[model samples]
Target: MTRLILPLLAAAMLALPASAQQAPTTPALNLQQNMLLRCSAAFALGQRLQQAGAPEAAGWPPLAAGGREFFVRSSAQLMDEAQLSREQIVTLLTRASQDLAREGQLARVMPVCLQVAGIR
Candidate 1:
């Protein structure tokens, strides 16, 4: 079951629009949004794993903590690169979480996150 999920997740990510894969750059901000975006997805996946009583729930805290740290540490760089405020990034994270939940993609979360973290 797990073996099949990674490819599907990769395909799903690939299917997203190029704009969705990259953040809009403004005069003040010019960083690629991939890191933040992947972290956001991982964070959301962690939340879903926890809610679904999945065994992977045990990994959520570490994932969430790592994501938070990455976001905080890179916020200045990301903000400067994309002209996005901290609040805006938070909003993006929330929206990402909500979207994942709404899409019923819980089964895909764990494997995607593991891939995001380079664990699998």
Candidate 2:
């Protein structure tokens, strides 16, 4: 029993590193779906605000909020979408990962998209 246990433990130890070294098998989902979802939410919010007789600027809050969410979600989705095309994926992943390191970039862009969407 002791001899068997030792070999089993050794095998398990060896296998662990090999498994860890393997590239991730599962691909992540992309940002497009998330962006669409967020946009939908923002649009809905804007409609509600308008119906409630809130100022035009009221939509800005939710729109801006959604824009930021969309950007982040889109960035992640872009990373995932890259899987469909390996070369493009590498470039996008690198860019997206790098951009993520910069603080407030998403927030900055959010208002612009929201503005374009007529949120304010």
Candidate 3:
């Protein structure tokens, strides 16, 4: 047992520096940047759908859905890395939803969030 213990500890110690020396991953974009990108992408996607001739109502849904998925993903990341609160994330998502809803692709952008989520 004593022999096994020393070897294990020695191995662990040796591994630590190598692990540390491995450059950490470049930091991910923060919540705001991610949200901006997601919202913009959603808008672009929505515009494409509109141009493809989807009804205004139907087109909005997919964009909103895509946007929400991104929001959820961003919230999880913010919580994990930055310790942001759920409320803050919610507020951010809400504001983003409103902003995206107002884009020119939308005609009567009422309650677009559910529509986006409902998209496959």
Give the TM-scores of the predictions, in the order they appear. 0.48, 0.28, 0.36
Candidate with the larger TM-score of 2 and 3: 3
* lDDT by residue (tens digit), candidate 1, 42-103: 55466446556778566545444554445455556566767775544544554455566564
TM-score of 1: 0.48
lDDT string for model 2 (11-110, tens) is: 5444555544244343444465434433433443344444466665343454434444544454455555544333333333333434532564444444
Clashing pairs in 3: 61-115, 61-116, 64-116, 65-116, 65-117
Who is ahead in lDDT, 1 or 3?
A: 1
Which stretch of 10 consecutive residues in model 1 shows the poorest summed lDDT? 1-10
- State in Å the error of residue 34, model 1: 4.6
Taking all chains together, the TM-score of candidate 3 against the true structure is 0.36
* All-Cα superposition RMSD per candidate: 11.1, 16.3, 18.3
Clashing pairs in 2: 30-77, 31-77
Which is the leading candidate under TM-score? 1
Best model number under lDDT:
1
Ranking by TM-score: 1, 3, 2
The models' CA-based lDDT, in order, is: 0.51, 0.42, 0.46
